[model samples]
Target: MNGGVVTDERLQPDYEADDSSINNFEKSVSLKDLEGGAGQLPEQVHTHHGANGEATVYGDFEKDKEQDVEDLPTTTRVVTAQDWSSPDDPENPQNWSMLLRAYHTVPPALFGFTVTFGSSVYTPATHQITERFHVSSTAALLGLSLYVVGLAFGPVLAAPLSEIHGRNIVYKASLPIMMLFTLGAGFSQNFGSLLICRFFAGFFGSAVLAVGAGTNADLFPPRLRAIATSLFLLAPFAGPSLGPFVGGFAAQYKGWRWTQWCILFISIPVYLTCLPMRETYKKIILKRRAKRLGIAPPNGPAGLAAIKILAPYHFTISQVGLTFLAIGLGVAISTASAIITDRTLYQKRHRQALAEGRQHAAPEHRLYAAMMGSFGLPIGLFWFAWTADNGVHWAVPVIAAIPFAWGNLSLFISTALYLVDVYGSLNGASAVAANGILRYSFGAAFPLFTIQMYEKLGTGWATSLLGFISVLMLPIPWVLFRWGPQIRAESHYPTMIS
Candidate 1:
């Protein structure tokens, strides 16, 4: 039986019965009688006799009575549901006005920008930091590297918490904590204090990164999610790119301390942005509505269910591990000739399908940008290195950085969309959490060893090494594009949309 279609076997008349009383029973059983009341089953049963002196009975008396009850009309069930009162219910996030939706997106992006901007903003001040603390270059770099390490772990904890509480509350709680720690780092009296403070700032700041994608899913449907995702991704990539450029000037004139101060200053607006971000988690909203209406919740309080907690962790871990393998293999195999293209290309494909009357676009379509990005990454890295090696204009390598940044951004957004589309809003936060932890761990570790790699291998060879690795990873997006349907079909998790 299809979902929500109820069949009333108890009220269904049996033609084989010869008893005149059965006819009377059948007349009494109307559609209303079949659905007498919630959880009320028909007590009347019709009996039939066999010529061999055998008797058989029907009407919710079989061993599989529970299964039969499930097939009953939803109107006759004792289950509680928490859904929009009407299709146009204004409380449903999907029905929010365009202005309100835009309001929801920008604040998360700003929050992401301020936190990630701090990761690279202080790079230009590393020398000043070394001199002030009398520490080696490696030790001074820890200020930057450890912040990324904090980013990796922060989401692991925060995303899960968001699943329990709500996206708005997590933002309200985390932003201030991040701001305070950023201040601590700026005013630190010693090197140890600075590192400790920077790490804490990163940990708290990561809540936005951990949960922002999930927030987007809460607000937008699959069709519009692409644009929202592309915009949201800009912060993580653009902020890091712009930070060093801006910090270079600040480091030259205002000094190393100003870098931290600048981020803290910008944090003011980011914090204010959180004020209007209402609770967007569907379960929480439904629970609140249920309380107001004096009714039981549809699925009960979220995050307390065993499957909700465990399944998200399992799917998240699996996806992250697969991504890790792809990165490792790509690096180990070849990283060359990659270029970062606009992610809008994939969204364009989706819109095209919709225009052609296809309401459900293929999940693998999101991988289009990812495939292009895989190639772009190595090309940018190789270009930057070779240009730097030949002593070309400094601006040449700087311009070359664009492709690498673009490729990274495209890949991140594509994979993120894939996770959300496959796992849905409820579990998407956990998936993003796992991805952030692993990605940032690598982000953190790379800087720590980057200087050493360049010095020992020379810039050209070092960049070539990464280029070769990128070449190896080229197959990841390709394979997913080819086998995505089958892979998703095998998963225990449900896909929200194709």
Candidate 2:
């Protein structure tokens, strides 16, 4: 007797049946069942097949289904919010640790201090330079003016280049060029040679002033950027004030050429200090990181996604350009005011009095007073230029300038802070470009007709012309304050308020 696998009412053979007739009969029965007729197989047998054999056979199908679920793609998701509520997300540059931000900021500040110190140190050394080159005081002033011109224009090219190359590259390249020119400036034999070299040196040295601002934004977030910006701006402002003090002494003791050499000596240590400073611009840093990770660099949508995540508040180039223009215009107006009031008018009248040996010569303090009296550079220029021949005590113009330096510093500081606050990480490069363009163009153009104006119209009228220009520039700050929000809203760059 054959023993087959048993169900409740029928048996299924697990092995081949000994008789072929039984197998053929089973096939016929299955075909009849497919035609919708009931087979001879019992219900208990069907239940047994369904519970044991069919269930066991379908078990492998479930296992394959689970494997498919495991193979589905997964991704990291970002939640974009309109404000700065989170502190730990990588999106906020402010979220970076204090030590890291400091690392990015210190070098640029020192660089600015060094460069500006070098630039203006020549002011007190003008006499030494004149004696060395056998040129007049006006000609020596021209050399100083030429350097400022370089400072003005260098940033236009440097700022754009930094966008293409990393900041470190521009800094390293520009610094060395500045050094070479500063060093060469010492060896120049004639006035023209010195002027050309000084001009280029000013141009290259401007990198510190312009690029440093942008670098600070890269390191700090908007909430904390004001302090960083203040620190950066402090260098340039303080440098000019202090440079003449130090350069005066150095030029007095060591000679004018040594002023250039001393700066170069100081720069060596600063340059070496920059060795450990890492590049902070997110795009360049991440791109290099991707190469190291053996992943393909992000492209198209992926790249944009990463950039947007990293920099949620970035500004477009055009906005930055406009901001720079406004800043430049303001700076030019201020400078022209200074020239109109102080150099063209005050100095001219005061010197004339001394030359003629007037009965009651103006006290030297009048010069100081004129410098200190104005609301800013322009007011000081206005007071000094307008009052030069007024027959009042010379002390009046000098008293006026005291307010001028004060006001100028205040306005300049405020404007710088506003720009940094408005632009965030892009501040450094954008500021550099703006400063370079505005400072140079204005410095060059303002002084050109100034001498002629004073000579033709005399000090009082010449300064009044400048005072009127200052009044025009006065509306700039008010306009910015009122419409700044709308302007910032449209910017593609990151701003402090955003």
Model 1 lDDT vs. the true structure? Answer: 0.63
Clashes in predicted model 2: 34
Number of the top lDDT candidate: 1
Model 2 lDDT tens row, 270-379? 88777777676554554543333222344422222122222232435454333333333433444345344445554676578778985322222123222332336576
lDDT of each: 0.63, 0.54
Give TM per candidate: 0.49, 0.47
Stretches of model 1 off by over 4 angstroms after superposition: 1-81, 298-498
User: What TM-score does model 1 achieve against the real structure?
Assistant: 0.49
